[model samples]
Target: MTSTPSANLFKPLEAGDPAVVGGYRLAAVLGTGGMGKVYLTYTPGGRPIALKVIRPEFSEDLEFRRRFQREVQSAQRVQGLYTAPVIDSDTEGSQPWLATAYVPGPSLGHAVAQHGALPLRSVLLLSVGVAEALHVIHGAGIVHRDLKPANVLLASDGPRVIDFGIARAADTTALTGTGVSVGTPSFMAPEQASAGTVSPATDIFALGQIAAYAAIGSPAYGEGSSHAVLYRIVHEDPDLSRVPAELLPLVTRCLTRDPAGRPSLTEIIELCHEISPVPLRQGEDWLPQAVAGSITERLRLPEPAKTPPPLPTVAPTPTQYAPQQPQTPPPTQFSPQHPAPGGVNPYAPTGFSQAAAPTQSAPGIPGPVPPPGHPMQPTPPPGYATRPTPQPGYHTPPPVVHAPYTGPQQPKKKRTGLIVAASVVGAIVVLGVIGSLLPDGSGKDDESKSPSGGGSSASSTGGGSGDGEASGTDAGKKRPDPKPASYQGIDVTENYLVMLAGDPPRPEEGDPIYGGGDLSYYVDSMFGDTWIGTDNGKFILLNNSQKGSLETCRTETRYTEKITLDQLSAGTEFCVLSDAGHIAVATYKGKGGAKESTYVTFDLTVWRNAEEAKEED
Candidate 1:
């Protein structure tokens, strides 16, 4: 019986499936992949785990078994934040199996297929995570050989690179001798495509392809027959025209034809960090809102079913029992006087049939039934604790304990506190008069407070209200409303305009595109309609009758849907809340001639909550 929102992701166990492996009971089938079938299981302490059992055909081969064992060992040593490390494995057994930490999220391939390409910021964050995973894998003297979208799982916080060492185990298998390519064709490096030596650089090339695939909802190298795609990978340049401009240079560098020319993992991480300076934490919000919600749904896996109760030793004998009343008995109400042992009902419906039961006492047995409410009762068992008899229609009440009470004590006499209060008040008044007559002991005027100069207070505090005061604002006046970061007359066209990084307002571009992909908004011209939306942020059109101010944008709730240009007017204003927690109000300025071009313009003013900005600092 499935009970969770994500229970549909798992399939019921088949008749032939092993109930237990390595002492862990299998709960459900996660899915089958190229390597093996994955099952949802739990450790002895009930921590959820993903158990991968190798296919029988692969486990039968002596060479495959040897390689699998070695790879499992190396994979066990790999401990990285972005990787699902091997928890347990048994390569010597008839059915080789390994368990890893179960990350609850859809695969990157599924996410992209369901929700187009990720925003530029999400892609950059993904690159950093995958690069970090590769760094750890390579440091353990293992080449991932296959690094593609399907191998990466999108968790709520970040990307988790799984199946790290499985590909290397299958690298020298007999299948390769049959002219079968070891890795995915579209994501393969030039060297790997041509059957050349594979190294850490090969994984780097694949990482670049994955990044490009994530930026655009397709492979870097266009899809085709295996041979055709492989040929293009080895001989032709990738179709990077649709890749986000900020990620273009980095992708190009990693996809370098020559293995030696490809940048190292450290360099790749550095490139991503340069593009997005903030360090990506393990549980940071990096995925698009829609994708993040999908991950959250996957995390709601059903709780494991309770262990089945042991079969009864002898069937119950009822005076007027009916034999044709179905093999299972009706559900019974359990009470404190007669509880189910191990929390399992012996006669409850179960998957296993009664015919398979052995004729002997089983560990799990329902406790003795309670006697009907009557004056006479049967004797209790030796070890059973005795309980008070419950009434015919009511449960026995719990025992109540009473506190000891002493005799009533005499009331204390009420104090005349008015006299005491008057005395204290008179003393405070006398001290105040004395303090007024005291001299300016320091001999320095109150105006000479800070030695650094007249603007010392302003200089010490730096930005915000300090800057306002330093700019000749009256001290008695309230600190002026915070000035928002603004950018004007931004032309948003086919290419995404990263509102977070635009000052003079230009398309996402830079020298080698090192630090640009901070996406905030984009213009989509699909189905002959121009729409304004975001892939990494939230957007809500407030109204078309009047323009919205910064305060309105900050307070308004934003939705994750696009607004058509027709719904917008010269006076229309909407709110954009980026994934990075920066909120901005974008007022529609104008658009290119409807027939001449497909572009819209907006004047955007960005603001970060003072608390958020201070935390970043």
Candidate 2:
């Protein structure tokens, strides 16, 4: 999938994220929310799962952790065709996390936003599936207080309910202080809106809102400020005019201010079945074409990279020695070995017994007699005398030298001690050079690069011995770090930490501070005004915009001299293509600088260039 399209859906894992949670290895970050982040992981059996880790701020709460543990136990008992079942969880661990069977599909909210409202028939089918899920949930004494379009995933089989019971666990926490409700404002029941009491009926009210959302493109209470919507929900009647006539009556009953007046899940399911032509189980064609395509793409996610294989083990072989013959000399005792000059290891059998050198007799001289325990000495050939045994404290006479004989000779074993020693030394030297040349690959090139410039000094070393090879590698050792695709909420100044575009589009003084090149963006007027300019690229200012608009730089042409700090009070965001050719986003984030007294600040996030990103992918 393209990063631009699913940019909001999936993200690469960030630093400090645990690679393994419990026993499941995290594959990627699914999405983040106010509570915590959800990740895509797999079970030991290779089944895909969605793991939701509780944020540290909440996990630190002893009360929240205890309630969370109870909720997890209850949620596990909820088994239904239309619910994403909880498969595993760890509530007592350092970081509590819950894992559920992954549902591969777009959420109801995303589907409605991407492909308008669902048709009448599809809405009925969705109602039936969601009602059945709620019936199962309530039967287990669990209430999905937080049920909305975002929590319902439209799977190929049917709609699947998620995030059940998690809201109830947080119901008594600091999040629900006094008048605050645990559920969403747009779909909360009247009682929940006022924080009086919450029950299974609250979910029925949310169910009505979800159906209306699917049939109509927007929430029934209408979208705006949360307080206004909650007030309307509590006192005012819902606007079901846009809702189809067939779904209007049920939606109205479910949205009743009095939860006692709402119909039970069974009745809702029966009513939906009366309208649906096909059984809810046969929902192969339930979703719209556009939504189905997105679901298919999610189901076809590529497998995660596999781990490296373990090292091999060598089995010992049995040692076998040829039977010693009478003519062969006996083996000698092992002696202490000295290393060769240049610190090389001398030739020595790794596991085998050492053999002794054979004795060679002089041409015409008689051979020395054996020790007393040996067999009788051999008779001297013809009239030659046998060597006499040496007396105590007396040394034996040396054998006499003679002229060389011209005759056939036996082959002698080749001496390979020196050759083996040289080979071992060369291998060690090569490994050392290779290790020195290997790049650290940490991607901190901008700070780690040699201050003298590039690697001119290092590369000047000529190649010959091991040192030359190591020096030659230094030139490439300063590999440019991966250019940052984007930065977030970085505080920058004009002189010290000016915004610059390069490998990392972070807040740092570069050409702008050195009086060399133009600045991408700089603070001025003592936190009152900000200047915007690029060396060769363009910038587009959004008067009243959301952060999402900064995802891509607009193609239309326009430029403003500067934006006053007061004009950006409505969260104005600007998109600029840096001279480095990467798209960057900047948002006014109040007046305060890192070091300067009262300077303008902008939260910046830069993305890699489209072509460069594609090439790297």
Candidate 3:
């Protein structure tokens, strides 16, 4: 069966969001709230359901998952006419989600806002239905921790309680984890507002708040800030002026300050039945005509589109490794490896003849030509200077800046005492190299490119034999320290660190005091996750995330211009932002004048003139 439309609450799927969860086809988004997003979907058996996918941040939290899983188990046991039962779930996936029978109705909060206070008769039915659902939920050992107007659905038959996403076992201590409280403070129970232990009575207190809202189209406690509403809930009595006199007794009892003083759901239900104009039943029409008609329209609304198809997985040529048999030599020990004279990785893997290399390469990616006809050996990609080749005893070095690319190059290191004379090709036999290089699929352009100004004189000698002989003594030497050009006296870190731009292009040995670069390098690099600022001489990392706009380098990063990286070292503490997906550092001279500050502004203007390109290829 097709799912229903979300009444303007549905949003089109975004990039990176999944089209299917487990097996259900997600058609349209129902809504998005605090925990994650809810989608309109259907089971294979044609059962319509609302599926909620946990957000990335919440999925990554181990503690939250535990509580969610436990709460889901309890929610499944809740069976009530006023509650949407949990039908399916996957709490162990990379991102968790739960599916429940669809309740195609607007929230009580929405209904009240759109059509004013529900009639006293409807409110009485709403009160009775929710109280009964709570009875079932509490009996199943679950407490609806975040019960507010938004969580209460105004179904034609009665009100349905939903969004048990944060519900937890009534008996569990420290509901989720330390230092985290989840609930809408405006409608939260007094104990919850004070961060006290939550129980079934806690839900009862919140129920009273929702009932109050449904009666007056506003909160019973004065509508101000959250703190104000919560203060009134705890310290003062609710303003019963707007509430019809009939609901005052039941509402007041539920809003009692003491959890023990509040009447049980059974007691509230009996009182509601006494006052309800019509007998409450499973199919009772408790909602007014306008409100019930809205629900009817929602259920009949057609889903505008079909579920999207799954995205295709395209495999790039370079990362395809050909299978091979293990080579058996004199079982020689492995030794340290070095790059060829021009800083080329002799062991770079070549792509299969069937696939041609793409012209646009990621940073540090090298195009290696295979030898005439020898067995394959492990080869590093063009721009990847830090991935350790799976060969024993030899250490891989950084990518080289060289001219005149040549045939498949072998690693510059060797086994201490093993040299096979197996069938050979052009002047040499390929060693234990594998077929194809499997670089990460991310579009990293680390190919060896010379910095704009001029090549720096700074260079280090890689330790290895001048001839093709394997020297175990020199092989064990640590690969020449990572390029010390990013920071003074320290090697540039692999993976996390990337030097966006700086005064010298490379770092100095003593300190970065006088060495700095244009602040606009951040704009040039388009690495929107970090921000760097300099005051006097010492450079500090700024909180990029708080920078207000994502176009700025400091959009989502923790370090802000106000914070200093004085306590952090480049490699050990933070790394450069390279194709290897590591930390990166950008530096420039003290406030480098206005020339560097306006870097991003200049780049945006270049976009219009892109039609005036030098080469199309």
Index of the highest-TM-score prediction:
1
- Candidate 2 residues 362-410, lDDT tens each? 5554333333223322232221245476674343334459979978788
Per-candidate TM equals: 0.50, 0.49, 0.48
Q: Which stretches of candidate 3 lie over 4 Å from their true place?
A: 1-7, 165-181, 281-284, 301-617
RMSD of each: 24.1, 27.3, 22.9
Residue 45 of model 1 has an lDDT of 50
The CA lDDT of each predicted structure is 0.67, 0.64, 0.54
Which segments of candidate 2 are over 4 A away from where they belong? 1-8, 177-182, 277-281, 308-617
Backbone clash count for every predicted candidate, in the order shown: 0, 6, 66
The whole-model C-alpha lDDT of candidate 1 against the native structure comes to 0.67
Ranking by lDDT: 1, 2, 3
Query: 1-617 in candidate 1: lDDT tens per residue?
Result: 23564656878789867666654567889988777889997654556789888876676566667788899889988999899978777776667788888998889999999999998778888998999899899999989888888889998778899998688776534444233344678888887764456888899899999999999999988998876797688778999999877888799998899999999888988888777646644554677778888767766665665664454444333321222243332332211222233333323221111222223234554323324342223343222345566565352223448878878988988666987898899999999999976657864433434655575445344434423343332444555444577777877654454545344446563211111223323332233524564543457789655457666766666464456667878857888765445667778887774543556678777665421321111
Better of 2 and 3 by TM-score: 2
Model 1, residue 366: distance off in Å is 22
Candidate 3 lDDT, 277-393, residue by residue in tens? 667664546677888877765675345334333322333355333433433323211101211122221122211111223233456653442232323433332323444333432
